[model samples]
Target: MTPIRRYATAPGVPAAVGPYVQATSAGGFVFTTGQIPAAPGQEIGTFADEVRATLTHLAAVLAEAGSGLDRIVKLNAFLGSPEQLDVYNQVYETFFTDHRPARTTVCVGLWGVALEIDCIAVTGPGGDA
Candidate 1:
């Protein structure tokens, strides 16, 4: 029998800008959709601000799915401009701290947003369940 997929939502996190859920969990892992910087009814801002907002939303999504930033195993980050890479990294480090999840970052065209981030995390304590 196939395991059921569980969708996650958090009031503090911004709603999906497109037709997608915030995150989903299955088989002991939670996968988050790429989070854009713009929140509901909020104005998008600078590159650093976008990075912070995006990660903050990611954190909330993970938490809602019984995971957390520290439990994240991988991250796919997209930047609107390669020039903003340094700023993104600095702000990202502030949130991730010692939890060094494997990551990939690339420059891409984003609609009205400077950055987007998505992650995969294990469920339960220290992602060990």
Candidate 2:
């Protein structure tokens, strides 16, 4: 059997800057595109704010897909600089608190921003779930 796929679109979530949807769901899971703090080509502030904004985007995407940050099963993160990790984690903790998702963080070359993030979450409570 095939699981029908649904693309995600949420009001508060900014328009995706390129050829991609914010997220998609299938087989009881929502998978999001990597999200940045601001639209591509836009300048961002401190590493902490970047992390916060990106995660906030991720959460909004999830909420629109019938899930929430608490339901995240796994998260993948990219940091433009190794030094950004400490600040990133500090901001990240505020959003996650005790509900920790399985996660991976990597230092990578980014397109003018300090951070990017995405996640896979169980479809819980609403929308296409």
Candidate 3:
């Protein structure tokens, strides 16, 4: 027997600019693409704002796939610099108030963007997982 694999699409989330799906699920787990911090045509804001937007997109993708922020088991994030970690945590706390997933944040050479984030989560009852 073979397990099922599914591709997920998030409504209200602008189509991925690249050739990649927003999310995919298999074996009771959901994996998301790295969410860009800016919304469609929306200019990038402050470091905190960028983190908030990225997380919002991540949550939306998880919700669309029958998961959510609290369900996240692992989160991977990228930043333009290490100096913004404190500000990022302040904004991140607002989204992940109760459940905190294992996370990794790395400083990267990003162009015109402060952050990008992706996550893995457990599917809810609505999902096969």
List the candidates ranked by TM-score, beginning with the highest.
2, 1, 3
Model 3 residue 108 distance off true place after TM-score fit, in angstroms: 0.5
Query: Candidate 3 on 8-127: residue-level lDDT in tens?
Result: 458656568767889988788888998877754577667777787788888889888878998998999898889989999899889988788899999998766677888999985653
User: lDDT tens digits, residues 5-77, model 2?
Assistant: 6665676666877777888888888899988887777766777777878888888888888888989989999
What is candidate 1's lDDT per residue for 63-115, written digit by digit as tens?
A: 88888899999999988788998898899889988788999999998776677
What are the lDDT figures for the candidates, one per model?
A: 0.82, 0.82, 0.81
By lDDT, the better pick of 2 and 3 is 2
Residue pairs in candidate 2 whose N, alpha carbon or C atoms collide under 3 angstroms: none
Ten contiguous residues with the weakest lDDT in model 2: 1-10
- Kindly report which residue stretches of model 3 are placed more than 4 angstroms away from their true locations once superposed: 1-8, 39-41, 126-129
